[model samples]
Target: MYSKTILAAAAIAGVQAQSSINSTSGYLNYTTVTGYFLQDLASTNVSTFDYTATNFGLINRTYPATAGLKANLTQWQQFEAQVNALNADAPLNTAYKVLFLGRHGEGYHNAAQTFYGTPDWNCYTSLLNGNATASWFDADLTPNGIEQALIAHDFWAHEIATQKIPYPQSYYTSPLTRCLKTANLTFSGLDLPQYYPFVPSVRELLREGISLHTCDHRRSRTYIHDLFPTWNIESSLTENDELWNGVTAETSDAQDARSKIVLDSIFSEDDHTWISITSHSGEIASILRVLGHQSFSLSTGAVIPVLVKVTFLPSGPPPSNPPYTTSTHCAAPPVTSIASLAQGCVCSGTAVGGITTPIFNISSDYPTSAGYQATDLGPVVTSAPAISSYSY
Candidate 1:
């Protein structure tokens, strides 16, 4: 995360939730789900303005300027406005598009774990191990994950209704079931027919940060298509998870290279200027970098809207459509494995620390950049050593 604060334009509309300022954090964190999204969320609340039909504006959120992302977005918005001023007959107008990027809701792996108050050397391997007591390979969203999607869906629906946001003419998702499910859940009930198309296709290039993590391992294409019949899978994608091996994974540079190819295609094709991308938090960071911005962190199920502008010279070959390819390169460090410790807990994660009670911190014996939230995560591990009483 960067130090620059961004303009927050998307406030919760018709909210009846209660919020209190944390004397320590110095930000208003709303903890209720009374807002129409039908899920709990924490945001920096600025006002209590009630927007009615007369005073209309529904805001989901505005992206923070983390890691130069907001700066890139700002440049794109300016470029787009300039393009609109150019004559439609001019050749440059067709070369650019704006895409909205987002992450999936909580997956089973995201749910805290069940060490069950005692460590099992066989069952609980390294923090990066996916062979947990309760694991979901290439997982689907948990119930709480579904709710998070609904909240995003509600936000998009409201924004579309008020014309605060544009409708997506093209939609793409990672082949992973979790991402596919999240894309569907988020746009299922849009007021516009085209908002949620009959089929949202998967793009192999959109897969999560490839690594040794089992959760990153994808099932065969036939298996995924069998589960989601209405959706379309890329014919070029290999039948099996050829891109990922539990042994060797795609590095950040490789993923960034892939992000570039996919993004160029998305921007160059004359199909649609407004697009949506559903992918993982790790990979999204790479995508942001390929677009000429520094990467920022995203929690599970969080979204950041971006207005992308592709610059085309007076003469050049158009970008290739689909069948995009990227070279592999950078090894991502191991991410910690999270546990569900208790049943009925929501599954979510964030690399950034926040107002929520701290679970795993830098002080831990195995301090990790990774963190989990949703109903007690670490009391089981607290007594292991000089651990502090965990709260989040």
Candidate 2:
């Protein structure tokens, strides 16, 4: 009788031990899967005084240099705080996969040249210094552009080395030259292998006046099929269309297609552990919107990673979308109005400590030491991160 009891006790202990091991392994797996996006920050907020209803003037007028500066500064601070919080709240074994979205650094194009008014053929001229032979779509990154890519690359490298997130398995870019250059520089800086699968189909919808229905054509579907030969692009497209209205040439449609492509690629293959994509702000913003993020803007050289959790059970349907939610802690800061002055100067806080200082130091540095000392640092910098105009 005592032997029987002892045997039962041993069996119970073994089962408990096995369950504990499985639980630990599951936890470790959960921590390692993450996705990220980075973008060139553009100020979208416009002041009431400067409001103009015509020609998206509302969006263009609010440059990072002027009224929108303070908002951008606040957004970055909030985003960084969210990142820190996620690292803290997640399990110690969790790792991350980063997706970076950015605008090509400053180019030769005139800022005043509006996309709506400018001809597509002429678009390349200002951007490419009138060199017709040069490929406008794939132009080289400007000097400052390279610097921006390095900033993101260095930050990610530090995070991966110290935080234990896996290096990206693939790097994707638009067919455009500038985007390609940015991706190459980033991968080279990180010392990672390059895997380029041209996604011209992704860019098709972004072309001047393509319709959502046209974007969904079999030809477009075929292109996706070729890029990801094993995945069912058609089915994914169908699903996305159902969820986000039909796919059109509109920025919103392009975003839907891109997000679906990404999701399908990740789920289709088990071998690929991490992926990274380099694309524009409009597309990135759309993806973020679909993922339930309210309004988080991407800054130049900034990277936003979304950590999605998934589970495939033996007896249940796969969750419609991966269990992913962005960190709500990264909410944008409250808006503050600056009093307009007739002649005196207004200054926002300078970029310091990798985080924008809250207090805008509005002071004039004059020759006289006494005058310089007396100058007051104005309101904090609230400008939005510099975002590239999609029209370009």
Candidate 3:
């Protein structure tokens, strides 16, 4: 991945030498992640993201915010920093609560399509040969992804000192390598006097939309523990991935149910007023839906701050597949099947977007796969907007 971004000088003294070349970053630095889908010439038909609009800070809009509580690039970065600072200083009685939503940076899978082309390159042909899987399995951050995270770190560090926003007292991340890596990179270098060693919790529920794709099949738990020794993972997760099966994928309702579980666990805990959840684009959309907000799209490495009002009713049973509809994004076509796979199994209509769910049809509209759209729930849970900021 670094090879794609930073220009490397020839080896010096049997060691790698750093090149001084600029203009080497992979994927021209488009401010938003969704922008890639729009900007790719190959995907010209895909709708361009409304970068100029106020999109709840999910897309890469610039800060201070436009009207409508939209995020500029710095929304989460600034919020998280302020959260820690405020949490460390607030009086014992004051509990300032906020939820910070963030999406992971670009991974090998995102870059793969551009390099290999789609359909066969995206399906069994590329996956079975290990050509794509080798580079994208449980994809980690591309060089550009890391750079985005670095920008997040600097932005947060600068904002907490200067801006007035709630920073996160607790941090959570998806189990995927791309998301975990992004979380670590975004929060590692901050100079928070309150929480120096702010180790984030890894929740399996935070994983991306489940699918048969190799990129969706996470590494084993033991392997994950080894990879992220510092992260505090949920004890409940016992397998590499519990939901994804090559033959079938998780439905929007199922994913939303999972999102509810994530929230239930969080609200169950008494502490951590302002929390941060770092996950994939699909999972993030699920979260917004479960929280009763308009579905919003997010660019990788971007953040949104929502003033959420959650009502916890532990004794009551959870809603049964909340009444909802997903705007379909999958478009299917026949492709050569994997020796162990079926012809119509992958890339089927409305299922092509197995990992990310559906395309965010409108700039501010939620992506197709959101959870809990039912209106008859016992408690009233509402999600309103708040301000956002960042540094770099």
Candidate 4:
């Protein structure tokens, strides 16, 4: 519900003259401009591309606008010039932006999912706060997750130093704990422009799909602010999460509806041409769907840069949003489950549970920093070994 324009980046030399579009007053259309980034190419497979190693997927090519700049600029510098030129020449109703969508580093829940297998995790373990090993409720980034974020931090530092890549003028993150921590670690200590710091706004709509899993339930807003004091908590983010009810899982249609709403809010209010969003795999997928982009799943800690063209339109009928559906899960670990998470598992006992109520409380004693230990919670039932790589 909270969105705002970032005027700070307009001070950048080349972008100051761009025409502005009134995205708030009318309906809007979003389209992804292909042929610019390698990630968008039909031939480039996402399964193998490591964005950190590939200059964040910027194609190695020259832009028409770059001829006026220095002769030996890096590919990213040339690309930045091209984006600025696009914005500068855009019509009154159209605006161009480069959205850097990044998925958070591995969380304990991701590790838990891998350890327990998809079926068991989806049916039983995912509902519990944590087993003996660690807590996945509003799951924190594991040590490996921290390492992945640090890799992103180093990648950003190198990009800014060598490629002259345009840093994000405005930042946004999901209200979930893993995303909050990932955004902090990924952009915190970089040599950013004075006007644009790593102060990301915590957005409620950017959270993961409502699956009624403990990991999908977020902590209180106050806890988020206390952990990262400098972050901008969205104005409408309630002190406690108001949307999750632990009984119903959001349908893809429902998720897409909210994703469009959040994207529309951002496009209307935030005028910055370069933006960054840190969120989960499912939510990011929903955003890509809303933006009319191809289905490219991101590995944990991976980043994708999208060039988006948004046009304001006359108001029309709103899109239909299907209601959330009740998720039936096993009360205890199932004897066997289908590989697919969408299907129900087979339980040994006759008892089955439907997610209808919240199970965990957001305690004030939640750790204030990332340095807290699993031992602080209790003894380990089973150790969740650090996973180097995995995706949703």
Candidate of highest lDDT: 4
For residue 311, model 4's alpha carbon misses the true position, in angstroms, by: 0.8
Worst lDDT 10-window in candidate 4: 383-392
Ranking by lDDT: 4, 3, 1, 2
* TM-score of predicted structure 1: 0.56
lDDT, candidates in the order shown = 0.48, 0.32, 0.52, 0.76
lDDT accuracy of residue 309 in candidate 4 = 83
Q: For residue 113, give model 4's deviation from the true position in Å.
A: 0.6
Give the C-alpha miss distance for residue 205 in model 1, angstroms.
0.9
Sorted on TM-score, best first, the list reads 4, 3, 1, 2
For residues 1-392, what per-residue lDDT tens digits would candidate 1 score against the true structure?
11113211111111111111111111111111122111111342213322222111223333232233434333223333332332132232223334467789888766633232112211222123344355455766889889888877887776656443445667888988789889989987677564446367688778887653446667676766777877777776666655543333455665665676665444433245556889998888887776654345666777764434344333343332222122111122212222432111222243421112222221321122121111233342211110011111
Q: How many pairs of residues in model 4 come into backbone collision?
A: 3
Give lDDT: candidate 3, residue 69. Answer: 49
Per-residue lDDT over 1-392 for candidate 3, one digit per residue giving the tens place of the 0 to 100 score: 11323322111110111111111211111011122112212333223343223233332333221234435425544434333343344332222346667788888776775665565554443232136244576777889888877777766665565443345667888888888888888888676547535678888778887654557657667766877887787787655344443334566776777676666555444244557888888988888777665556777777665644333221244344432222111223333323343322345543323322321111221112221111222342222111011000
Q: Which stretches of candidate 2 lie over 4 Å from their true place?
A: 1-104, 107-139, 160-164, 189-248, 310-392
lDDT of 3: 0.52
- Residue 31 local lDDT, model 2: 22
TM-score of 2: 0.38
